[model samples]
Each structure stands twice: as C-alpha cells, then as structure tokens.
Target: MRKILVVGAGQSGLQLALGLQAHGYEVTLMSNRTADEIRYGRVMSTQCMFHTALQHERDLGLNFWESQAPRMAGIGVSVSGPGAERLVDWVGRLDGYAQSVDQRVKMAGWLDTFAQRGGQLVIHGAAVSDLDYFARVYDLVLVAAGKGELVSMFARDAARSPFTRPQRSLAAAYVHGLGPRPEHPDTEVARCNLVPGVGELLVTSTLTTSGRADLLFWEGVPGGPVDVFQGVTDPAEHLALTLDLMERFVPWEHARTSRVELTDAGGVLVGRYTPVVRQPVAHLPGGGLAFGVADVVVTNDPLTGQGANTASKCAAAYLRAILDHGDAEFDEAWMRRTFERFWAQTAGPATKWTNVMLGEPPEHVLTLIGAAGALPRVADRFANGFDDPADFENYFFEAEKTEAYLSEVAGG
Candidate 1:
C-alpha cells in the first residue's frame, strides 16, 4: 500500500484525501479536530458554489444535490447611483445549482465520507512540526491547509511573482434581521451600489433554507485608514453605524433585526479579517520531493468567490497527476505537473477576476448588462460558472463583452 498523508481537514484537503484513497492509496488524514469539535454554526458570509463545483460533486457520486442545495436561475443585479436604480435581470441559469452549505458542513461531510471509505482520520493535538518524518514514512505529503501558518513553509514572497502588487482590502460582517427577501425571482443575486467618486459597495442576499437571510456588504476604499472589519471601538456604536450605513446607501433586502426570531444578542457581530491580497506562493520548501497545493500556496480574493472552487480544481488535478505517476519517482513528476497545470488552466482566470474586482467598473459592464437583459441565452451561460469554465472565464472579462453587447443594443 502506498502511504500518503494529507494535512488540513478543509474542503480541499478532504477532497484530495477522498480522491487519493479511492484510487487504492493508503491515505492518513490528520487534523487537530475531532468529529464532535465540528460546529454547525453559520458562516459569516455565505458563498455560492458554482454549478461546475456541484456537478463535480455529483460526478464523484457525492450527495450534495439531494441535500436541498438551491439552484439559482439567474442574477437580478440592481445598480443604485445618483440617478435611480438601474435594475438588470441577467437570465443566467445553471446546469446544476450552486449549493450554499457552510464550509463546516461541506468539510465535515467530506471527512466523514472519507472515514467510511477506510481512510484514516487522526485528531492529533500537535502540529506536524517536521515534514521530514512524512518524507520517511509516506510516498507523499499534501498540504491543503488553506491560508494557515503552514503556508509559510513554502510561500513565495512578492519578489517571485510577475504581478507583485498588493491586493485590495475588504470588510465583511454577517448580520441577522437584515430584512425580508427582495421581490426578485432569482436567488444568488447581488446589488452593486456605486458611490460616484469614492468606491462601490456590493451586497448579496444569501439563500439559506432557514428563514434567516445572510447579509454581506463589500466596499472598496483608498489604501488609507480604512477599517476592513467594521472596526469600531464600541459594539453599540458599531451596530448603529452599520445599520445607519445600510439604510442610507445599501438598502438591505429586509428588516435589520425585526424579522428574525433568533435568540442571539443583537450586538453579536461577525467582523471580517484584514484584506491583504498576497501573491500565493508554491515553491517546494526543505528542498524535498514534496510540494504545496491550492490556496495554501495561492489564494484569490473572495470578491470573485472562487477560492474554494479553485482549490477543489487544483486538488482534482493534483490527484490525477499522483495516480498517473503511482509510487515510484512520484514527487518530482507531481510538482512539475502540479504547477504547470495550475498556472496554465486556473491561474489566469483567478488573476483576471481579482484584477477586475480591484479596479473600477469598466464601461463594458453597462453594455453587458443591457445585452444580458435582452438575451436570456447569454444570461444562462453567465450563471453556470462552476460547470462551464468558458462561461466563467467570460464573466471575469465582462468589460469587453459588455462593450460588444452595448453596440448591439445601440444598433437596435
């Protein structure tokens, strides 16, 4: 049996472990978490897993679909500005629905399933202080730790990347009692409030089976003294300021606290972490035969909501490379294929999306909006991002497409 050790119990790690064990490898999944340690609490910000990801789960025979994951038909985007609300209904539909299960459920499910498949799950309290041990014991060690401290082992500093510039900062809070749903028919919708010369704020209403709706607010600002986490000194002051800001500019879907009957205190706020977008590094540390995988090495900004999806894709690609090479001479071939495939297939798209979010809205956005409203086919392609890479790729470069669509609107 070929022994392989996977660190981290997140989605990417579980997916990689599951993929490897299924191929008859002796896999040991280690994390500092026990089954009971898993929490069912809701994540601060709800993210949409693209249809492609859902379809991938189905293809792997995972039961994500039967779990009541909502299939979002299209996105109803409302751009509020000085004039009025320019609402454009983009009729995009997914082949499979993007499920909004919290990261906890998603990770726990994958880990539990892996255990059932004869994979070992170790709940060790100590960190893996030495990679040398894994080098001696297993044929390989895969680090899917996301953005944990373990990344420092193999992180490539800014000096390495071609586009080595700092990333935009973000502040996100998960709040309850936001309000009732918008009158729009689609789920997974986002409202972009453009603040003329300052910056833009994008708010999305999270779709949960629970009556409680998840409210997410994202804003862009100059690299000065901006608190990315609603960083007010007093809790009372923070809640009041947030409520006031939402009412004045970003009209939330529903009431702030009146609608939900949750017992949690109104002052309970989930603030976002500082947004320091770094060039994700993946060089082999220790000069060993092993390498890092996915976000542990490279991470895209959450604005694109592509981090989990990108990590999963990388896991899939790495698994294939490992299986193809088998046990003998595995390390060298794996690293070469891993970096090559990631840079070629995924890196370009991730970078494109990140840059778009950081920069100002292009004129093409207006054009694409009008075109998508008039054409449902174009809209459908826009929504099925997880399954259709081509469509997903187009969404990142929407500025160009928007211009073309605008010309059509003008001619008509």
Candidate 2:
C-alpha cells in the first residue's frame, strides 16, 4: 500500500483521505481540531452541493445526512427593487437536487468516522517543519488545508488570480424557526436575493449540529452600506444586523424572518478574503515538495456558491490521478500536470464563472437572468448551470450568442 499524509480536515482533505483509505492506500489524516471542538465551533462555510459533488460523497459512503438534510429541489433568484419591490423574481427546478450540511457538523462527523474505520488520524496542527520531516517517510504529502501557515507556502499565480483584495465582506448566521418562502411554502429551496449595488444575500437550508436549520449569509460589497459588520462580536447583535439589513433592502425575505435567531452563541461568523489561485506545488526548506489541493490552489468567492463543490471535485480528481500513478514517483512535474488537467476540466469553468459574477455582471448576463423570469426553459437551464457551470460558457457570456440561444429555447 502506498503511504500518504493528507493535511487538513475540511471537505477536500477528508474526502481525499477517506477515498485513498478505501483503495487500500495507507493514509494518515491530520486535523487541527478534535471532533468535539469542531462540532461545537462557529459556523464556517455555506454550501449547497449540486448533484455531481454530492455524488462524489455518496460513492464514498460519506453522505450520512442525505435523507435528513433538506433537499434543495430548486434555486430562486430575487432582484430587489428600490425599497420593497421585487423587480425580478423567479425560481427554477434543478435537474437533480442539491444539499448543504454545515461544515461544523460535517467535518466533526467525518473525523470520527475515519477513526472508527481504523484509518490513521493525527489531531495535530501540522506546521511546515513537521510536514518537511514527513516528506521522506510518505509517498506523498498533500496540503489540503485552506488556511494557516501552510497555505501561504504556495506562491500566488498572479495571472490566474485577478483580485488583490476581498471583494465582499462576508457575514453568516444559522438559525431555526426561519419560515419558508410564502410563494413556495411546500418546497424547500435556496434563494439568492441580489441588490444591485449592495452585494447579495444567500438563504440556504442546511443540517446543523442541533437539527435542520436555515443559513442566512450576506456577501456585502466592501465599503458599501451592507459591509457594516466590522467588530460586532456578539452573535445576537450579528443576527440583529442581518435581519435589519434584510428588512431594509429585501423586505420580501425579511417578512418571514420574524422568529429567526442564532442556533448557538458561536453560530454567527464574520470575515472576508480575496479570491485567489496559487501555484499547485510548494517547496519546503528541506527540498521537500508539497502538493496543494482544492482551496490551496484555487479559491473563489462565495457569491457563486462553488467553494465546497469545487473542493469536492478537486479531491476526486487528485484521487484519480494518484491512483493512476501507482508506485510512480510523485514528482513536481506529476503534481503540476495533475492540477492542470483538473483546472482545465473542472475548476477553470467554476472559477471563470464566479470571477465574472463578482464584478458588475455584463448586460448580457442580466438580460439572460431577466428572461428567465418569463421563460421556464431558460430558467431551468440557468438553474442547472450551477450544477454544470460549463454550460454557461455556451450561452451566457456573449450578448449575441445569448440572444440566439434564447430564441432557440423560445422557439423550441
């Protein structure tokens, strides 16, 4: 069995480690926190895993909460009007459902699961010196950690990463007692409320540590009015600010949030980060090579809701490459080539789509979304594009092509 040391315990790290273990490879997974600590920790990320990413989990028997978690059958887009008007409101069915399981809940469960299954796990904070020492012992050392002293080792790919600063201030809170959209009371769905100059709000249903709950997340344009959560450390205060903004800008959404409150004292989180893409391989002081995975290589803003999905896909891709390279040296060339293939096939489209959405969307893009309000086919196609973002490249980016595609859909 090939020996592998996978650092970090987030979506990508755990997934890759579990996958390799199942394949008879000797894998040691390292996590910075214990399962209990993560379980009770602050809410970390907002995710709505579309069909493909979810399948990667199910195939590994890692989807323990599927039936319990709310099935996101569709995605709705609401463009807020000045004050209370909803200028454009439409929801479209996804070809296959999506789901969000809180990372706090997920990572904790996966950690325990890995240990129960007899996989080697080290609950230690792996620094560069530690990883450099392990380099000689393991066949491969994969750095899957998204943050910390480790991630900075990977040099920024300046050409690939366009943003020098965070585009949005991110605030999120999980709560129970949040009501469903009155328009679609029976069906569970994820909603994106867009306020032209103020950034966007994403309301997603997720399974939390206590039980099923709703996640209200804001991606506020920096220095804009919505970017107001700087030092409010109290969870109650954070939630109040979230609801207050919702009432002012997206009253239609706020109307149902009367009963919403924090799921825990640590339920609310506030932070911001630049969307970046870094070189795939990092060199250590001892001449050891560490292969970067997922967010370590490519980080996109949450505006597109692709972070967890991209991580899932990246882990799978790296797993496939590692399996194919049986007993071969995991040289720098091999690492670069593996990442290049994944970038071209999967991450590139997701990154390009997200980067495009972060700026003032092109006129063609707005026209396409507006048309979806009237055309079910257009809406469904647009909704499914979140599952397979490459589809957008075919019909979304160009005005002339978008018109032709819409005409085709309308005629058909």
Candidate 3:
C-alpha cells in the first residue's frame, strides 16, 4: 500500500483523504483542529456547494447535510446606484439547487466520518520544516492547507496570477432572526446586491453550527465605505456594523436584517487575502517534492463564491489522477501533470470568470445581464454557470462571444 499524507482538513484535504481511504489506500489526514474543536469553533467559510459540487460529494458519500441544509433554487441579483436605488433586479433560476452548510458543521462532520472509515487522523499544526520530516515517511505528500507558513512552500506563478493585492475587503457573519426573502417569502435564494464602485453584499440561507440561519457577506472595494470591519471580534458587534453598512447601501437587506442576532458567539470572521495561483510543486528542504491542492494552488477572491466549489472539483480531479497512476512513481513530473489536468478542466475558467466579475464588467457582459433580466433562458444560463464555470467560456467571458450569443438569442 502506498502511504499518502494529506495536510489540512478543509474541503480538499478531507475529501481527497476520505476518497483515497475508501479506495483502500493508506491515507493519513492531519488537521490543526479535531472534530470536536471544529464543531464548536469559529465559523470558517460561507460554503455553498452548487449542483456539480454537490453531486461530487454524493458520489463520495459525503453529502451529510443535504436534507437539513437550506436549498437555494436560484440567484437574485440587485444592482443599486449610489443613493441605494435599485437599477435592475432579477432572480435567475437554476435547473438544480445549491446548498450552503457552514464549514463548522460540514468540516467537523466530515472529520468524524473520515476517522470512522479507517483513515489515520492526526490533530496538530504543521510547519514547512515539518514537511522536511514528513517527506521521508510518506510516498507522497499533498498540501491542502490554505493558510499558515506551510503555504509559503509553493511559489506564486506570476504569469497566471493577475492580481497582486486583494480585490475586496471581505467580512462575513452567520446570524439568526433574518426576515423572509422579499420576492418569495417561503423560498430561499442567493441574493447578491451590487453597488457599483462601492462593493457587493450577499445574503443566503445556510445551515450553521447551531441550525439554519442567514449568512451575510460583504465584499467592499479596497478603501471603500463598507471596508470597516478591521478589528471587530464580537459577533454581535460584527452584525451591528454589517447592518449599518447594509442600511446605507442596501436598504432591502437592512430591512431583512433589522432584527438579526448572531447565531453564536463565535459566528463572525473578518479577513482579506490576495487572490493568486501558486506553483503546484513545492521543493522540501531535503530535496523532496510535495504537491499542492485547492486553495494552495489557486486562490480566488470570494466575489464569485467559487472557493469551496473549486476545492471540491480539485479533490475529485486529483483523486482520479492518483488512481490512474496506479503504483507509478509519484514524482515531480506526475505532480505537475495532475495539476495541469485539473487546471485545464476546472481552475482556469473559474479564475477567469471570478476575475472578470471583480473588475469593472465589460459592456457586452453588462448587456447579457440586462438581457437575463427579461429572458428566463438567459437568466437560467447565467445562474447555472456558478455550478460549472466552464459554461462561461462559451457565452459569458469574452466580449465577442457574449455579443454573438446575445444576438442569436434575440434573433431566435
């Protein structure tokens, strides 16, 4: 049996480790926090798994919260002007729904499940120097940790990375007492309110550490009005500041959150990171190589909410590559090839679409959004792109492609 060490317990690390174990591989999964700690710890991410990613989880028997998590049937986009007046508002329906399970809930449950499946679980922090020691024991080491000094092992790929700094100042909090969806009171949707030149606000129904609640996310343009949560630690205080920002920029959301309260004491998170793509092969001190996965290789701004979805796809792709290699040397060449396959199929398009959304959108892209407001097919296509970003390459990314597609829709 080939022994594999997977560091980090986020979506990629746990999913890949569990998949390899199920396939009868010798897998050791390491996490900084244990299952119990993760369950009761602060929230990690606003993780909404779209249809494709959800199917990947189901195939691996990892869809533990499907029945309990709130279902998001569509995406509602409200673009407002400086004065908080809505310029265009529409809800784009998706063929299949998406679901958000708080990482605190999802990751903790997954950690327990991984241990039950006969995989070795190590709970501790790992440093880059630690990789030098681990490189000698395991046949192959995969680094999935998105943060910490260990991540510095992978060098940034300047050619592929477009941004040198964070595109948005991000702040998120899980809260209870949010009012019903204004458009369809009974149904939940991923509501995004964009205030051009200022920032964006996203509100979605999600399963929290406690239970179902709303996730309020603010993405402020650097140095903008909504970029005010630098030192806020209390969840209640975070909610208060978030509510104030919403009231001034997105009144509709403010109305919904007027009576909102924190889901728990540790339900808030505030931070910022520059989106980047790093070289997949990291050279250890002892001249050994470790492969990067998920955010370790390709980190994108959460403006498009693609972080968790991308991580799921990366795990699935890497798992297939490992199974196909079948006792072959897991050398530096194989590591690069594996990441290349995943990058070509999944990561490339996702990064392009996310970067496009972050910057000022082109005229043709704006036109498509306007068309989607009136046409159900256009709206559905746009919303479904979140599930498979590769779909954007056909009609949404390039100016000429979008214009040509829109003309055909109009003619039809």
lDDT of 3 by residue, 81-146 (tens): 768988778888888899999988889999999888888999989988888999999999999999
What RMSD does model 3 have? 1.1
Model 3 spans > 4 angstroms off: none
TM-score of each: 0.79, 0.99, 0.98
For model 3, the local distance difference test gives 0.91
Name the weakest run of 10 consecutive residues (lDDT summed) in model 3.
252-261
Q: Compared to the true structure, candidate 3 yields what TM-score?
A: 0.98
Q: Least lDDT summed over 10 consecutive residues: which range in candidate 2?
A: 78-87
Each model's number of backbone clashes? 12, 0, 0
lDDT of 1 by residue, 1-412 (tens): 8888888877678778888887888999887675545534434234556655555556667645345544454444545555334454344565655555545456666777888888888876324455656666777877777555666666454533334444434544445455534555335544444443434444444433342344444454545223334455554454455445555554543233444332223322333333222333333434444467776666655655666676667777777778777656655555766666775687556655555655666766555645666776555555454344444454547556555544554566
Rank candidates, lDDT, best first: 2, 3, 1
Candidate 1: minimum summed lDDT over ten consecutive residues — where? 260-269
Show model 2 residue runs off by greater than 4 Å.
none
Candidate 3: which pairs clash?
none
lDDT of 2 by residue, 1-412 (tens): 7899999999999999999999999999999999999998888898889999999999999999999999999999999877658989999999999999999989999999989888999989999999999998998999999999999999999999999999999999999899889899999888999999999999999999889999999999999989999999988899999999999889988988988878889888799999999999999999999999999999999888999999999999999999999899999999999999999988999999999888998998898899999999998998888888888889998889999998998898
Q: What are the lDDT scores of the predictions, listed in order?
A: 0.56, 0.92, 0.91
